[model samples]
Target chain A: MDLQHIRQDFPLLRDNKIVYFDSACQSLRSQSVIDKIVEYYTDYPACGGRSMHKLAARVTEEVDAARATIAKFLNAKKKEEIIFTRNTTEGINLIANSLGFKSGDIVVTSDKEHNSNLIPWQVLAEKLGIKHLIVKSLPDNTFDLAAFETLLKKNKVKLVSIVQTSNLDGVTNPIEQIINVAHQHQALVSIDAAQSAPHEKIDVQKLDADFVVFSGHKMLGPSGTGILYGKQKLLDNLQPFLVGGDTVASSTYTEHEFLPVPEKFEAGLQDYAGIIGLAEAVRYLQKVGLEKIAQQEEELNEYLTTELLKLPKVKILGPEDAKQRGGIVSFYVEKVDVHQIALMLSEQGIMVRSGQHCVHSWFNAHQLKGSVRVSFYFYNTKEEVDRFVRELKKIMNVLL
Target chain B: MFCFIALIVFAILGIFSASHRALAKEAFQCVFRRVTLRACNTGFKEKMQAKILGKLINRSSRVAKFVSHRFELLAWIFFILSIVSTVWVAKGVYDFYVYGNCNGLNSTGFCAFDPKGNNSAVSTISTRPCSLKPPTESDLTLKNVNVSLFPTKNTQAKNKVVLIGCYLCDYTRKAYPLIKKFVTENNVQYTFAHYPTKSASSYLTAYVDCAYQQNKDKFWEWNDKMFASSKEDLFKPEYVQSLLGKEGYDVGKIKACVNSQATKTLVNKQIDQLVGTGVYGTPTLFINGKAFVGPKPYRVYQFGLKPFLFF
Candidate 1:
């Protein structure tokens, strides 16, 4: 894959000439994604499932097509299993509220999980009297499979909600093994692929994950669009969290019967433009091929991590092995504030996320200052990584 | 020759006192026409004579005459007063030029005819109101910066996410959802503090606090509506009342509290407290008392709050 050729598709990169390394936070949109969104606004500016007109029918067809495409991309059993949400947070909240965890029922999560996966369960535990169990990570920030197993054995585990990749350090959890362990204990598992989905192809069927949640914006789609894929049997069993206009089948003055699966969960008007844009984003990813995207990110991460390690007083978060990590490399300098470093890098037209990378629990548990996170995507290059390191060295001198 | 010497002195003083240029012109005119020599005095001695005799003559004419005769003593007193006034004016100008404010207090009005020209905290350019606060006090030992006591979504536990914003501000509205997402995503604790831009914003902020007083759940509902409203509809009491009524809130109680002196003081005190901390704009964030101004992208907040999270 030619890096230069792929870089041309992202207008923000070409126009701004910025070295964007904050893909872990949100990905830069390809022109295709932008065009798809524009097409929705200009050609078929109508709500789906609400009207019988040509424009509305076209919108409904396109939205259904996007859903089928997303279902196929994730390898879900059926399109009915794919639920569209505002983002991963809402997706997680829907499941957390619907799962019906009674008092004393334990929901286990990793220290490595993003707050999206962590907080909803925390709120559930507090509000409903359920047990919110946190499985601590190993010293190197790898998932403690042993600790996770111990928690499962000791308690009646209801669900094991975990992140596929640590947004803070890009440490990919051994989720397949985790899924097997949780299944052995008759516990369901949900995966937060917010950090992993963009760089890697997620086959929910192969992994046998009960639920998979990720944001579309993190994967080159527009903001306010995300996917929540649940197994058909599980989606059928769990109660619908949101209820409104489109979610119900039929309503009386006093009561209403809900629609089945995905429609039941997707309440009110959806971000149809964003949903359509997501289909284009997924096509763009598929055209590039997930394996190639993964390979490019690994190569970039290895180079960036190695260069970052060469610098004095730099401490990399998570495992030492770059291959074990995803597309991110986060680190901190001794006696220097990471935000100051980020601002300094920003002045050089190089962008990186500084601080805890939204995994504040990990930093708070470990008692360290937030690290500067440089997350690479397919469009990033060795040259940009070199520029980032050079800028970091300059920033270090200015900061110290 | 004496008049020529006086003219030279007046012109020289005029050149030095450029700020007092009008006064200098008037002095030049007085000296040019050789009008009443009393004009040359700038009313130092004669004004003193008038003040002293006017009071003395009220009681006794003999005493007033005797007092009026002591022009030498009165001249010395006038000379001393003139020197004191000159030093006072010079000090004020020096303070205004060096510190961007006269009287050495940011709260006080600047001196008249100041070259810097009403250097208020808000407008560094020449403008009337003294608006800018001092740099946000990094020292977090204050009464007004209240930590959020309620458990918000994502931040169920006590992890620090202090959001200082104006309810009426557009950026604050845009920022609220992003901030809420960030806070929930990290499972960090959250705090909402007001740094209102509009006078009406203070009441809106107080309404949320009052909502909290009535019901914490209602506070979140009120808070959401405040940020969600269009700029035109944001401060309208009827709109707010309608929203509250939809939520089944006692709008009467809220209305009464809004108008109450106690709640007004509570809101004003909180505003004063934040102002004291040096917050000048909406959407300023303080993660564990680490202050940063303006609304930033998600990544900036993600990484910016890291060090503070541990602390």
Candidate 2:
């Protein structure tokens, strides 16, 4: 696919001439996605599933279509197994709520996990009597499968959740290895694919994950839209965290009975416009091709990372080979302020993210300040990388 | 030379100020001369003071309107801060109404929603009015009643019925459903009064009398129709019966009632007694010389009407 054609679809980049390098945090929207969101509101303005009107029926059908599309994209066993959620954080909380942990029941996760994955488990461990143990990541900041297995040997471990890719280091975790060992020990494994899914293709059936969560915003979709894919039987066992109008089959002043899984999980009005926009986003990505997007991003990251290393006093963290990683390239200039660098780049029309990237646990574990992340996507060109490098070099000199 | 320069500067400033004052004076004087010269010639007093008062207003406005037009951050911050303080003051106004000890020491007037002062603690001290003994059948006390609790025309019928029945007219609340059902059962001519409700037409008066037509239900129909025909002409006793047939009422029954007018007099006397007992508005109910008035909750109505259930 033509990168120019893909770039044209995003008016933000074209008009501002912005080189967006923060797709990890939030992806740029394609015109198709924007039009779909706007069209859904302005043209057909429907209250989904609320009325017997043509608009409501059509909207309800659209929501179902999105569910099916997302489920098929994730390669889940069934669409019913997929629950629409506000975001990945909510999905994690949903699973955490349902796990029904006892005081001695243990859940294993890695240090490289995002706070979305980490905090729910941590809160659960404290609030419930459950024990949450973190498996130390390897020296390269990748998942240490052996260490995870050793922890799993405790036999009290009932659940294992891994960030399929580290937001901090950008090293892809060995989900295939972890899932194998986890299943051997009769533990249900979950993968937080927030970073991995948009850049790479994910087959949950192939990975054998009991549940997987990833956000729409990270995948060039609108915010407040996310998917929680769970195994049907396990999801059936799991209780929903929030209970409300849609979730209940019937309610009275006295007692209430909950409906089946996905509906029970999604309470309140679903972000109908966001979900519609997200489906278009997914279709746009699919059209460009996820494999091709992955390939192009690797090329950009490799060239960018290689150029970044040539600068003095800059130390690159994570895997050196871009092929092993997603599009993210995080690094810190020895004597530079990350925020200032981000600002400087932003002024140059190069959008990069600075901060802990919301992976505070990894930062705390490694004992390092936040670094600047220059993430590339399929639409980003090599020339944009060259300009970014030049800007970075200038910013470093100014910092010194 | 320096003193000379200072003098020159001050002279220039004074000249400019004085000239501006003269120009403004001349402009106003010109307008006043054009519009009010003849009036002043007639010796009108108020217009003369306006010019004098206008100076003070203009001076104060100069200071108050300073930087106000610019909408700068400093002005905005101060204005917003003052507005927030106003809401805070308004929110705290409940302090003036509470007798003995105020129960709002901890009330935030926010969703943190402390209904009884304390966040989680139940109050030992009562937070309501002292309970008074309701009038019994044997002792019907006509204490001052407030009748302003009925629904206005805009309120839904069910809500109006429920509201009037459940609260203010607690003494005669049973009369509402009884009168309403009776009107429907009797096929009494009545329509809910929508607008211009104060003009007391003779037709409306006849309807009220008819509602008291040994049939409790006609009273509701009478009240509904009377308040609805709110024209001053309709209030005249001479044409009141004639106006009754205007809104599709039985003119003959109304006219005959008016010709005798005994029932109308009784209804009027009852209304006067209700008003005398301080039954100022809608839903004022007089039962056995007892006055029940004012809006109350649904539970209050259910409880208040309990004694009159069998009656």
Best-matching candidate per lDDT: 1
True-vs-predicted CA distance for residue A314, candidate 1, Å: 0.2
Candidate 1 lDDT over residue span A175-244, tens digit each: 8999999999999999998988898888899999999999999999999999999999999998988889
Quote model 2's iRMS.
25.7
Model 2 steric clash pairs: B147-B281, B168-B294, B179-B217, B201-B234, B202-B240, B203-B240, B211-B218, B211-B219
- Alpha-carbon RMSD, each predicted model: 36.3, 26.9
Q: Which stretches of candidate 2 lie over 4 Å from their true place?
A: B1-311
- Please write out the lDDT profile of model 2 over residues B1-311, one tens digit for every residue: 11222223334465668854443443344446546533222111222222222233234534323322332354346546656865765554433122101223212233222234222121111111223642222332344532232222222322222222211122223334543453344322222311111332223444445434434444444454443444454446545455445545676776676556586575455444433342233343332233333222232233233434424
